[model samples]
Target: MFKRIITLVILVPVAIVLILLSVANRQTVTLAFNPFEPSDPVLSQSAPLFVFLFAALMLGMIIGSLATWFNQGKHRSRARNKAQEAVKWHSEADRQKAKATELARSSTLPPPAESAPRG
Candidate 1:
């Protein structure tokens, strides 16, 4: 519930701002890829200013996410190694426990007799 409220609080304002920005910047703008010709570009496309803004924002986010993931590669590898070590240790403990149980069952020692009550 708390998470949901926080998400709503953060997202609601951002959503409102983005909506307002898109509405305010609805004018068409041409994006030219050709640097050689300024007058007429061979590679160019026209789109709303907000569309480019959103596209750049999304691209930046994806690039950032990839960079973070790459940077944490060593940490992720360490975690995987630790998890495998834990599994190995757990299996070893189980094996030792089973061996102890088997030894106890095979023992020939008699059970202790109860002491008599004093009169």
Candidate 2:
């Protein structure tokens, strides 16, 4: 519930701002990829300014996500290795426990014969 409230607080304003920005910048603009030609380009696109802004935003998010994932590779590897080691240690402990239990069972002495109570 707290998380939802926080998300609403943050996202609602961002959404409103993005909506306003898109509405305000609805004019069509041409994006040229060719640096050689000033007026005409081989690779170009005409779209709303918001479209480019949103595309760039999405691209940046994707790039940042990839970079973060790549940067944490070592930490992820270490966590995996530690998990495997923990499993190995746990299994070893279980095996030792079972062996000890078996030893205790096998080494147990028989019950003494019953005797009458003396005054």
Candidate 3:
């Protein structure tokens, strides 16, 4: 459920952008980075540039979110390991307690005579 909501949140903005772009019919100007002169015809336009920059920004945001998600995965694994260790320790303690009880009962019995009767 939570995953579905997060997916929707991410997609909503992208959908809105596409809708807006389709509705508007305007040209965009883009700056060309060259020492001599602007050559590329596509770079000479402005509308495409705005869309390109917005797309880049959105891509960066998605990448950052993925990085955070992977980091959280590491912490989650650490927590799981600790929980397993705790369970193992509890079982070991129970086993030791049982062994101690058995030993105590056995020790209560009388011991055989260590030496024969003296002359």
Highest lDDT model number: 2
Candidate 1 segments exceeding 4 Å error: 110-119
The Cα local distance difference test for each model comes to 0.94, 0.96, 0.81
For residue 98, give model 3's deviation from the true position in Å.
13
**Where's the lowest-lDDT run of ten residues in candidate 3?**
41-50
> lDDT by residue for model 2 over 8-119, one digit each (tens)?
9999999999999999999999998887884575588899999999999999999999999999999999999999999999999999999999999999999998898887
TM-score of each: 0.85, 0.90, 0.38
Model 3, stretches more than 4 Å misplaced? 1-14, 25-28, 31-50, 86-119
Q: What is the C-alpha RMSD of each candidate to the true structure, in Å?
A: 3.5, 1.8, 8.8
Ranking by lDDT: 2, 1, 3
TM-score of 1: 0.85
* Residue 80 displacement (Å), model 3: 3.6
lDDT of 1 by residue, 2-108 (tens): 99999999999999999999999999999887788654656887899999999999999999999999999999999999999999999999999999999989995
